[model samples]
Target: MTAAFTVRVQDEIAEKLDRIAALSDRSRANLAAQAIEDYVAREEWQLAEIQAGIDEADRGEFASANELASVVAKYVKAARQA
Candidate 1:
């Protein structure tokens, strides 16, 4: 069972949502629901990845924060060059 609620969106965002609904042949409510579901799923996946990293750390498969910072700095320098 689902409950209905009203929300106020910015004019431009509402217009964009309406266009998306039309293009997808879905009601605006359905499109919004699907988008929210996808967002929740992605968030859960990210949380799982973080948990896995913590588990790896517990197993001694990790680097120190200073080491990680150095690795990140290397990537940042390379990215800036590119």
Candidate 2:
């Protein structure tokens, strides 16, 4: 099953999409649908992860000071090396 809806885009973006569609030999609708699907999936996954972190915090699951410092130190060391 499929549903149809309308969306508006800026002229520049529409032009870019058209170019990509032509180059890839795909319809603008197909490319737009795929882009929307990927965006929605990423947002859903991010929201789920955020909620899981909040649930963990509600149960008092958090990194200790030592653990936090260790992570910071590791990153700082890596940055210095870079």
Candidate 3:
């Protein structure tokens, strides 16, 4: 079972949503609900990870400077390849 609610979106965003819905052969409401669900899940995960990091910091747990440089160097190497 599900509950219904009303929402207002900007014209451009609504149009884009409509276009995607039509292309995907889905109702606008279904697409909107799915997008909302996905967004909420992603945000919840991000917030939890942030809180965990804060707790770690509070506990005085941190990476060594060499560990940080190693991570940064890996990214820099991958970026240069790209």
Candidate 4:
């Protein structure tokens, strides 16, 4: 079961939400919850990656400049091909 919570938005943001809700035929609360869920997931992923990087640094795990260039070039080539 989920519980209700209160959130406050400025007038302009509220108006935008209202318009989106009308166009999508969804409730304001539903759109807000979806937005919040996405924001939380993205932030959590970023935080985990940052922590992993810090842990790697603590163990002195790093790539050389040439190694980095090779990986970047591989992806760039693939992106251009796509």
Candidate 5:
């Protein structure tokens, strides 16, 4: 089942969507839905990774922020020298 809704976009964005639709031989609506679906999937994956990191922190399976910062600084210094 699908529901229809109206949306307003900037002229430039609308024009780009039209061009994409023409080139892809897809309706603008279909392209918009696919784009939104992809965005949602990416966000879900990111949230899962963040949750795993939080769980690891709760379990004390991580380094101190200062230690991490020092390691990062060392890498940055090496990159700068290279």
Candidate 6:
């Protein structure tokens, strides 16, 4: 099953899409559909992760002080190195 729809984009974006489509040897519609698919999949994963975190919080699940400190120290060390 499939659905058809129309969307509007800025001229610059449309031009960029056209260029990408040509370079990839794909039609504009195909490229657009793929882009939409990728975006939807990424958003769905992020939403699921966020909901899981909320559920965990509701159940009082959280990292211990040492765990938090470990994460912070890891990032701080990385930042200092950068």
Minimum summed lDDT over a 10-residue window in model 6 is located at: 1-10
Give one digit per residue, the lDDT tens place, for model 1 in 1-82. 9877787889999999999999989999998888878999999999999999999989999788999999999999999999
Q: Per the 3 Å backbone cut-off, how many clashing residue pairs does candidate 6 have?
A: 0
Q: Tens digit of lDDT per residue, candidate 2, span 1-82? A: 9989998999999999999999999999999999999999999999999999999999999999999999999999999999
Order of the predicted models by TM-score, top scorer first: 2, 6, 3, 4, 5, 1
Model 6 misplaced regions, further than 4 Å: none
**Cα deviation in Å at residue 75, candidate 4?**
9.6
* Runs with alpha carbons beyond 4 Å of true place in candidate 3: 76-82
Please report, in order, the local distance difference test score of every candidate based on alpha carbons: 0.93, 0.99, 0.97, 0.97, 0.94, 0.98
Clashing residue pairs, backbone N/CA/C < 3 A, model 4: none
- Between prediction 5 and prediction 6, which has the larger TM-score? 6
Q: How does candidate 6 fare on TM-score?
A: 0.90
TM-score of 3: 0.81
Cα lDDT of model 4 by residue, 1-82, tens digit: 8878999989999999999999999999999999999999999999999999999999999999999999999999999999
Off by over 4 Å in 4: 69-82
Better of 2 and 6 by TM-score: 2
Is candidate 2 or 4 superior in lDDT?
Answer: 2
Whole-model lDDT, candidate 1?
A: 0.93
Question: Candidate 2's error at 54, in angstroms?
Answer: 0.7
Query: Which candidate ranks first by lDDT, i.e. highest?
Result: 2
Q: What RMSD, rounded to one decimal, does every model reach?
A: 4.0, 0.7, 2.0, 3.0, 3.0, 1.3
Please give the lDDT score for candidate 6: 0.98
